[model samples]
Structure formats: structure tokens, C-alpha cells
Target: MTQDAQKDSSTYWKKSRVELRAAGFDPDRTAKTTAVVTIASAWTNAHRCNNRVRGIADLLVELLAERGGQGLVVGAPAVSDALTQGTPTAGYSLVSRDVVADCFEIGHYAHHGDAMIVISGCDKTGAAALMPLARTNAFGLVLYPGTSSPGKVSFEPWAAKGTNLTIMDYAEGRAAQEAGRISAAELVELERNVMPGSGTCGAMFTANTMSTTAEAIGMMLPRGASHPADYDAASDIHADVRAQARASVEALYRLMEAGIRPRDIMTLRAFENAITTVYAMGGSTNMYLHLLAIARAAEVPLTIERIQEIGERVPLISNLQPHGPYAMTSLHAIGGVPVVMKELLRAGLLHGDVMTVTGRTLAENLAATPTLEEIGKQDIVRPVGQPVAPANNHISVLRGNIAPESCVLKLSGKTLEKGEFRGTARVFDSEADTMKAIRAGEIKPGTVIVVRNVGPVGGPGMPEMVMLTIQLQGRGLGEDVALITDGRFSGVSHGILIGHISPEAARGGPIAAVRDGDTIVIDPGQRTLNVDLSDAEIAKRMAEWRAPDPAGRLRPGSVHDKYVRLVSSAHYGCVV
Candidate 1:
């Protein structure tokens, strides 16, 4: 071994001995100190992109050493080797887990002997890492790859000049089939212009929402969740992350010394913190599912009703798209999640005593950090009592005859038409078909555009189709067009459309029973979605209507199946 490696090994062994002694181990028993096992798992896809996961592992191992412990890095063989090569100076044993869960199980078992640090990113990998940590009640910290780097693209031109084109304009196919057809590359360029930054896509998509939620819930360090992967600041941030890992291990040791258990801190307050953050951020509807799954994994009884009750009171505050005008960077500039949490506290919306991954009380941490106003102009981060709205405004649960199990809608204001809207239903089975017809000028005013099979189990992933609804605003009848779907709309696509019409078509919801020409009426004032037909007639139609099989040729299963299965088993709002 090289001199540096030899020094690291000796240092780690000495530190391990010190820690064991401090933990009250007999001097003789210290020689048999349990081996700390670190699970450094990365998503298969993220691993292919760059050395993001490997870097996280390297930093974690360094942190473990600083905390006076040794660990073994375990992951897929390829990722394990990459991490081993990158952190050669770190004196940690290397191991491999046959599967992602195997890593957690082995890590949990190792906790009997040693502590653990989990370095993970991406969707599935994050979930996998969290599961075993929760089960083992292990001391762990997650190192996300952060956001993507901003490329050499600029949105200044688009900002300076207005195209007068909306999502509706594209849906109408006016841009797609027009004589002036923009190439796919041009479309990509346009998107790049709008998304000019180095944080995961900048939209309120799944990845961004998950990261933001993670920060809000105190899983990752404040501001630790927003750095772009390729930013020059990444290396320094990586060092900070290493320090956090050391702190985490030290925290676990302190708790064990004091007879405090992980369960003592992982309370309902944490879930409440998560809920408040989700609402304030205008987070992904999928968060509803993810939160539910997380609660289940943690053995917490988080029900849809509890979530809705919280949602009803937590006002949307984050001004990020596809809800508001800003992006993650802008939010971070305005003090990021800390500002939001402070606002929640001031508003009496959050539990101040909630324990965070940092091993400090939420309030204590906030007091130690810079004030929200100091990070940005005061106006950027809204004050608590004087909110952007009275309470959480984006997500609401609705129940009526059409939706017996309950449905969700992104409500912006109380300005929905009070009485029933009697309109001829123009049904489209797919988003593509609906867009095609809209582009062809086939849809007319006073039309309720009913899109079916886009529900949780139907769309499988319940893909956001609100982009199409937003596009409709550019058409002459944008104001007059009302969209109703079994799927969901973007939180930003408020006011123009109604989504999350539950009991999706695949499950034979009332929405599937409506005929193309039937008059459909939605009375938000009364919380109702009704057809002109009598109940008997509706029941007869429902009996005759055939639900579409996702397994059918039209929508055959593939990788999308993972998302579909997640949705199918997901409890109401819970994403599996």
C-alpha cells in the first residue's frame, strides 16, 4: 500500500479504538470493534451520467474517518470499485451488495457491529436506501447528486421578446403541423432557453420536488439540496457534506450514550414538517403518494384524510414553476427552504420542535442560521402572517357522487363558477388525440373537454397533462374551454382545468360512463361532477362501458410499468 493509504489505515484503526473505548467497551473488546459498513448506492442511470455517486461515497468515507470510525463501502460491484479507486487514501474496507436491498440489510446488520452512512441519489435508489435505514433505525445521511449544470444556453432573448405562444398554441398543433415546422433540435433549444439553469430541470417535476421536499423535511442540510452538479462550488459543498456525515455518526453515538433512540425523534412532527414543505413548495402531486409510502415504511399511519387536512391549511408560498414564476435557484437565492420553514413557524403552521437530520431542534437550527431576510430582498421570501395566500392553496380533496373515494384538484382561488356549467362533452381518450383535435379546430366554445384513462392507474404514473391545458389558453376559446380528467394537472395550471378525477376509467369511475355528446356539468360551489342523465341511465351505461386494459396493444407495458405498478398499489394519494 502507498504511504498515504498506510497512514489512513492506521489513523482509522486508532480512531475506531478510541470510539469503542468512549462507548464503554472494555479495552480487550475494542480489538474486536464491529466494522462500520457504508452503503454507497447510486441509481443505475445516475451512475452512467457522471461520477456523482462515487464522489458522494468518497466524501462520506472521509467524514466517517473524521468522526473516528471506519466503514466498508458497499454497492453494485462497478460503483463500489469506482468509489474505491476515487477514495484510495481512505482506509475503509470495500464490499458489494448483490441487490440494492441487500446493501441496506447488510448495512443494517453491520450496525450491530458498526455504524453506517448511505450515499444515494435518483428515485429508486433513494427509496431503497431509506427503507433499511428506517428499519434498522440506523444513523444515516443522504448525499443527493444535486441539480444538473446550466449549459451554455440563454433565456434573455425569450424574456426580451414575447412569442404570444402558450401551451394551448402547441396543443392546437398550430406549431407542430404549421408550414414553419420547428425541428426537434429547435424545440429542445427552446426548452433550454426557458430552463436556463443547473438544477434538475428547474420545473416542479419529480426530481426537483423530491430534492426540495428532502431539504424541507430536514433530510439533507439546508442549501445542501440545491447545488448544481457541475458548479464550481460543488467541491466545497462536498466537503461540507463530509462534515455532515461525521456529525451524523457522532450524533448516533451521542444518542446511544444518552439512551435516546431514533424513534424518539422520528415523530409525527417530521411528517407534519414534510406536509408543510410540500404545500409551500407547490410540490409534485406524486409527493402525496411518496409521502404515504414513506409514512408506511416508517410505520407511521399517514392517511389521505390527514394529508388533506394539512393541505387545506398550508398555503402555497414557493413561487417556482410550474406553479409560480421562479425556479429552484431563485428560491435558494431567496433563502431557500430555511426561509420557508421560518415562515411556517411564524405563521404557526409548523412544529418548531421537529427533529432534523442535523440532530438539532428545527427552531435551534433556524436561530443559528442566517436570517431569511439577510439572504435576499425581504420581498423575495414572503412573510409568514402576510402570506401569498391565506393557507396552502394548491391541493384540495373533493368528494361527490362522481368521485366516491375522493378526488384532488389544484385550487388557486375561490373564483370557480359557482353553479353548474352545462356543456356538451367532447371526449378524448388520449392527450395526443385531444391535442390533435384541438389543433384541427374541432373543439368549440362551451365544450367540456373530457380526457379519460389518465388517472393514477390509467396514466400509470399519472403524468402531468396540464401543460396541454395551459396551451389551450392561447386559443380563442381558452377561457371557455373547461378540461376534466381522471389524471392530474400541474400545480401551475391552476384556474383553467380540473384534474385528479379519481375512480379512474380503468376502475370504471363515473367519468368513463359519460357519452361523447352527453351534457356534463361541474359545480365547484357544490363540489359535484354530474351528467344530465338519471342515475339509472348512468348505471346502465357504466355496466355496458368497457374499461381499457393497459396491457392491451395500445398501451403495452414496458419500463413505464414500474411507475404504473407504483401508482396502482398506491393508496389514494400515496405514490407507492
Candidate 2:
């Protein structure tokens, strides 16, 4: 070994020996001394999504020991967006991503681990897990605990006769109840069955989107992003995931032996691959923020503008989740993300030469993988030529007087059909007020909902407004109205909406000056969002505009306060 390598090995031995001894292991007798940190969100009743992570971590620790490596489990904080949605507690959700990354970073530093294994299952965990691995440039891989099995539910008269249900269905069920289309007991039944067991949400929301992103970013093993979470080794149907878990452990050793690290795998091209995957697969808007944060951690120059540039060239091919008629499990049943990646590769949309944690190029790993056509005659992942939405037809990055830095608009089928919206503004300062207006049936068609003072610094977390959008769909006015916010929306949120408006209201952006009945236009084809008011009028309004009194929500120097102080604008990925 080189002199520096020898010194590093010696230091690792001394540091690990002490930790092993403290944990009741005889240092000299133990042949394995290399510390391998396994970062996981410990089991919690807050949500089923994270309850599987601890078990995966335990499995990793045992497997690492069998392979002559000393493994240590590190707990990272996690929050459920579904559970916290629309509540003040929602302020803690995005903050948890940065907190989880910090926890993993501290744990790696404390253990002096040369390698890491992160098992993730929540909306934030996937991105949080990757940020530290990239920052540290360690030999590590991310394991998605897999998607939760779709829940079974039946609705009559008001809805379809399907059994598949997800959290999105449950959220919209409440809206159905409010609209008198469904009974409260029907909504209750949906709540009980929407999420049956452990794993991430069953749809193409933030969790599953980021899970796919990890693999495409070259931080996860092949075929690791889409397996069902409840499957066991005894079942023939789940044998692939069992083998995937075992293969990951084996790949870890190979990566270590080759001195390959996450940075070596997560290159600019890899980030581009990830962006292409997100666009092709109908991924969440949250992926934009998460990818930006992770790219910053990896010291990559991945910008929201670059993400839009990639989205412009890649077609939305996957027919899944809030945008389509399928769940993530349907894609898994047919071949998972590799099927989509292979199609992109064939169409020259992906960087197939990027390195991956498997100690091979992405193209090499996918060489033998089956495509959607070969897996079956499934339409879950459409061929690139027969895309769900053409390039630049899905996600539009818009800049206007309202969002000078930029904002994201998720163009759905209905929105694309209409092409443009010019409506009078129906302004609200918070999600709660908007929810109240929606419930009261005060919101009308041809109304552009301008919700400001809820940006990163404004909301102190940039909480998602899924409840509002879902209710609009439930109210039968989804296509007729548009929502604009400096905050964000859930991946499950659809309809004509724009989010992540930078120069947010809290920082005196033009959105703060918007008043009820002002004319606003949203044109996807032109890629612009603008209010009809003059620039001088907007400037005059901003000159007199005052920020809301945050003292009601923010505690001095609390985590939220710190996040508010450090977090950047949404256009920049809202990084701290």
C-alpha cells in the first residue's frame, strides 16, 4: 500500500478497535476492523413508510459482519408528509431532510467509516441519505426499502370499482366527502386501507421518485428501486429483491476493494441521467429540490435551469401515479426502472457510460435487463416514441414578474389540452385559508389561486399544498382553476399549478403584492407566468408591503427559525 493508504488503514484499525471493544467485541479476535456505517431511520409509529428501515439496517449489519466488516447502524430523523400535510407540523417535514443528512454526516465522522449503506423508505430519506454519501465520497449504496403494497378498497356510485388505493386516493376521498359525493364512512374506510403496511407510498410521489433518482444517479444497485416492501424470501414472487439485497452486500465489498467511492459514481453525467429518469418516469416536483440539494452536496453544477433543459429533451413515458392510471407496483410487476432506463439508453436520452456503485458502467449493468416489451406486453412504461407527453410538454420552468428567479409548472393532460389560462386572482396568504375557501366552495372557475408568504423562509418549510389541489379535483373544478405558490405541491398534486416561485413574498418578491381580482396568465407553450399589472405598480405595492408576523409560528432560534435563516430560495432548490 502507498504511505498515505497505510496510515489511513492504521488509523481506521485503531479507531474501529476501540469502538468494537466498547460494543463488547474482542478486538484482536475479530478479523473485521473496517467500520461500515449503516444509516437508517429507526422504527417509528409516525408512519409505516419508515418502519421497515430499521429492519433493513439490522440485516445489513449482520451481512456486513459475515463478510468480514464491522457494521454500525446510525439513526436518522424522518417525517411523513402524508401525516403532517396541512398542519403546522408540516413545517418540520422539509427541515428533516437537512437534519437527516447532518445526522448521517456526524455518524460517519464519529465512526470513521470507510464505507456506508443507507436504507431509505420515506419522501425525504432517499435524498437525505444520498447527500451525505456524496459529501463524504465514501464507498456506499442506497437501498430503497421498496414501495408499499397497494391497498384494497371499493367505492360505489361515486367512484370506480377498483381495489387499488394509495395515500392520494385517501386524501381525495376526504375531498369527495366534503363535496357530498362520498360518505364519511367511505372516507374512513379509505383511511384504513389506503396504506396497509410498511414501505414508502405506493404511488409515484416524492418517496418513489427519489428512490428511482438514487438508482439513476448511480448510487443504488440495479433493480433496487421498485420492489414491493412486504415481500419475503420464502415467496417466489419476491426472490429478485432478496437476491438484490444479497447482491448489494457483495457489491459493497467489491466497491471497497476497488477503492471506488460515491463521487466516483455520482458525476455530472450521472445527475443528468437522474434528471432524465425523473422526467421519463413522471417523477415528483420534490425531486427537483432534492436533486438540487444532493448535487450541491456532491459539488456538482446541477441547476434547476439545467433540470428544465433535460426535461425539455426527455419524454414523459411512464404512465404512473397522480398523472396516470397506475401505481408503482404495476411498474415493478413489469420490470421496474431499468426497463425505463434501457428505453432512454436506446433513444440516446441517458448517459449509459456513467459509473455506478456496482463497479460497472450503467450500460454494463443494464445489458441483460429485460425491457418492458420483453417482460410482458405491458403499457406501464411506454416506449419513448409512444410517450405519455412529448418533450417540454410535461414540466415547464417559467420566469415572469411573479417569479423572477423561476418557478416550476407540472403540466397534466387536462392542462396541456387547455394550453393556456387567463384568470382573475383569488389570493390567500396560507394553505389553511385556501383549504377553508376550497371547503366552503368559494373558489370558482377561471380563478388563479395566488398563495404567497409560504416560501422556504416564508413558510419556514415550504409545506406542500396537496390538500388544496386534491380538493379542487374532488370539487370538479380542477381544470377550470389554477394555483400559484411560492411554497410547493405534493407529487400527488395535479391540475394547472405553479410552485417554487423564487424571490418569494417573505423576501419582497412580486407575488406578495398580488391582490384578489388581478388578472394572471399561465401559458405553458410560451413558458411564462405573468400578472397583468405594470412593473411600476408591482414595485409600488412591494414598497408598502409588509411580511406577516412570523412570531405566531416561529420560536426564536428554533430549528424552523434556523432553516428560515439559512435556506435559499425555491428556484435554487431551497438548499441551506
Candidate 3:
């Protein structure tokens, strides 16, 4: 080893070197003169969405070693909400985010690593990967594993024009099958073809949304959020994904040398830029929770109300997935996320001066990026002047007698046009009961389906009810029925659904006091969610409310119990 490398080598460093040697690494050759880069990922054989990350992590580790740096591969718990839906384990979805973040933090801190590279490809994984880096303000970057290829079926009768099948198609297909709208053979075809390969879901769901937000927040390498996981050797653009990954590994060393940390890039303005992208893309409502959590970790002041305020000024321009008819890859073809960011910048909606992982301001990055017309003609992302939704009120923060602390009304242009919905509350305490009622055809038009006792406190994890919403959509009640919940919804969920109800039911929120036939009003214009009952009457009912026994759901002293004890309200990011 060189004397310069050994100059700062202490007894502790020698001990760490010995441990590295035992792990088959040449510590003297790699670690002695280089920074330690912890390559963290939520990789497992548990699901297709996350399973591909291990390969990316391995490639990064090799790249880091090639650059004379020591790379430590660390794996965190990976959970698939799509696989967990309708199961008891669904509650573990959001819980996994914290666990993954904690796991990576432990690994990174234990090694005293100088830099980090998080490879993630699932709904929660992207945000989970970001939390540790943001909390430590580490010199790092997040690599979205990328969206999967749609099924290669010649016939796509169910798919919208110019769009491909995704996991959501299968989900909605199952709901259609359940409703007898499609034959079993048709559902089987969708099941076989929805997800054809590795990577995250094809839609602009939480995974894609969070990945895009990461780019906008300046946490990801430029154009890194817009690549496909399954690369095509024939296409130079597709092949550049691997090149970008290698480049990002090299950039880490440069970043460490420059003393540019995550906090340097994840500033308040950077976060605002992320929120702007979320609104412009008509991105997932889950962005609200993830952004809130990440902002808290980064020590940047952000709240649901602030997010709402930003949304009010931004417009929804992207037409992709659940509410629209396009895939994430479609945006990729039109020059990726930078196209959307470029358009937003043109409209003066973005913080162009914000720093990014690419060692350039967001404006600098976009200045070199190809525009939609330059790349090719595409309408996947419309211009700011001609937005899909004139107002980005999708994340409408509602406060009234029902949700005093505020809840979220997820809206789209279609739902926004409807203005408001007034209906008799059809209260159900559990998701199962709500699903049962909907499947039984008991849910009627103008019915405000209130699913309570399933919030962060009540669920002890706040499981997403995407399947239930999908069922409602398949049964042709998406617009006809409105569902409000203390629990959350998946990014794939659409319709007149309001979620993340604060001061949740188990804590004796007014939602717990709701009874059948209680009149409820969901007005997006007024930004209010209220029941037609007197405040005194609602308070009286809540006075008699009792929280559910912990043992009745999850075991005492379980992870869920711990989360319940430490987790805050959903509006507060439900951080533990």
C-alpha cells in the first residue's frame, strides 16, 4: 500500500480493513486510497419489480471498484404492494419503506461510508432509498431501476390507443372479471401479458412518479429516471442506460471530492421543483406522503398544506396511466422527464437554479436535453398552456368538521369537472367489508363510501386500498360512487376518492363516528370535506368511540405495533 493511503489509517481502519479482507476484498488495493461507497438496494426474489435491482447494484459495485473505490453491497427489505394487495400483509407496504431506509442507514453508518448509491424499482423503494442519503446529506445519487416492458401481445383490445399493458391493466381486468364484464379467458390473457419483464410497473404509478420526482428534486442522475430496465442492444438510447449508470458511479467520486452533499441539491427549491413535476405529470397522490417524509428527513420544511398550495399553481400536463392513456416508456420516447421539466421551466413553474446530482443546475441539465419535438412527436406530455387539467388540484387538501386536521381529495380533470359530490355516507370499518359491499352491488350512486378504522393509527401501517378502488372502477361506479378513507390509496387508484384522513379513526377522528345514511359532502372547489351533522353531535358520537384492540389485528410487540406506537398521522408523513 502507498504511504499516502496509510497516512490516515488508524487502528480502527486496520480492523475494518481486516474485515474487508475476510470478505474477499483487497482492502489495501481498493479501500486504502479510495472512498467507501455503499451500494444499497431493496433487492429480493420476492417480486419482479424489485428483483432487478440486485443486478444493477452488482454493476455499480464493479464500476466503483474500477474507479479504485471500495463498494459495499447492502440489501434492504423489499415489499411489493401489488403482490400484497387483498392480503393481510398489505399493511406492511408503507412499513417496508421505513424498514428499508433504516436498513440502509445501518449499513452505511456501520461502514462509515463516504458515499452511497441506492438502486430501487418499486413504489416505496425509491423514497426509501432516498431517506438515508438525505438524512445524512451524503454524497450520493438514486438510480431508478426503470420501468418494465409491456407485454408483447399483438392484440390489445382493452388497451388505449398508443398505450401498452401494465400491471394496472391486469388489476382492472381482474375487477372486470369479478364484475362479469370480461370473460375468464380475457382476464387470463391480461394476467399473462400485463408485466412481461423486469423493472417497475409500466404505468406512472408510485414507482415511476417517485423516480420522476427524484429527477426533478435533483437527487438522480440526469435522464436516469427515464430509461427502461430491460435494455435493447439495437437501440443506442436504450443502451445508454447502462452507460449512465457507469457514469453515475464515476460522478460519485467527483461529488465526494467537491463536497456536494444531498442537502446541497435537495433544497427547499429543489423540493418545490419536485412538487411541480408531480403536479404537471398528474403523478401519484402517494407523492404527497413520500415527499413529506423525504422532506422531513432532509430537514426541509414541507407539509400537506404547502404541497396543496404548490399544486394550486401547477397544472397537470402529462396524460399517463390510471387517469390517462399512456405508459411511462411513452414519455421516455419523448425525451424522458426532462421534456416535462423543460416545459415546466418554460412556463416559469420550476426552480431552474436548483442544484442536481449531475453537478449542474436543473436549468443546465435541461438546456442540453432534447425537447419533445426534437426527439420525436408525442402528446404524452402536453404543453403548460394546454394542460390535461387546468388546475393541479389533484391533491386537494380538505378540512372541515369531518377531517379537522385535513384529508386529501385526489382529483383529475374528469373528476374536477364534476366539481363536487354530495351523498349519503355508507360507513364500513374495514376494507374487507367495503370490498364485500361493493362486490355485493350494495354500493349505490351518490354514495360516499366511508372506510374507517384503517388509517395509519388504526391499520398500524396505513395499507393502500388500490384493489378496492379498481373494483369500483371495473363495476362502473368509479364516478358514480365516492370513497373516503383514513387509509391511503395506491398511485394506480383514481376516481372520486379522498384519502389520508388525518386524526384517524383509532384516535377517535370524526370518521369513526360516521354512521350509515349520514350525509357527506366532498367539495374540491371549497377545499372542504364535511358531514351534514352538527359538530356537537359528531363530538358526542366520538366520545363513545373505542379504539380497536391491538391484539385483534396484529400481534402485540410486533413490527406493526412498534410502527403504530411511533408513527405520526398520515398528513405528517406517517414517519416513525
Runs off by more than 4 Å, candidate 2: 1-19, 40-43, 156-163, 231-242
Task: Give the candidate order by descending TM-score.
Answer: 3, 2, 1
Q: Scored by Cα lDDT, where does model 2 land?
A: 0.81
- What is the TM-score of each predicted model, taking all chains together? 0.73, 0.94, 0.95
lDDT of 1: 0.55
Question: Which residue pairs overlap in candidate 3's backbone?
Answer: none
* Candidate 1 per-residue lDDT over residues 149-171, each given as its tens digit: 32222233223223222222223
Question: Model 2 compared with the native: what TM-score?
Answer: 0.94
Candidate 3 residue lDDT tens string, 478-560: 98889999999888899998999988999878888889999998888888999999989998998898878777777778889
Each prediction's RMSD over C-alphas, in Å, is: 9.5, 2.7, 3.3
**TM-score comparison, 1 vs 3, better candidate:** 3
What are the Cα lDDT values of the candidates? Answer: 0.55, 0.81, 0.81
Candidate 3: lDDT of 256? 73
- Model 1: residues >4 Å from true position, as ranges? 1-35, 45-51, 66-132, 149-199, 232-262, 370-378, 412-424, 439-446, 459-482, 488-499, 519-533, 550-576
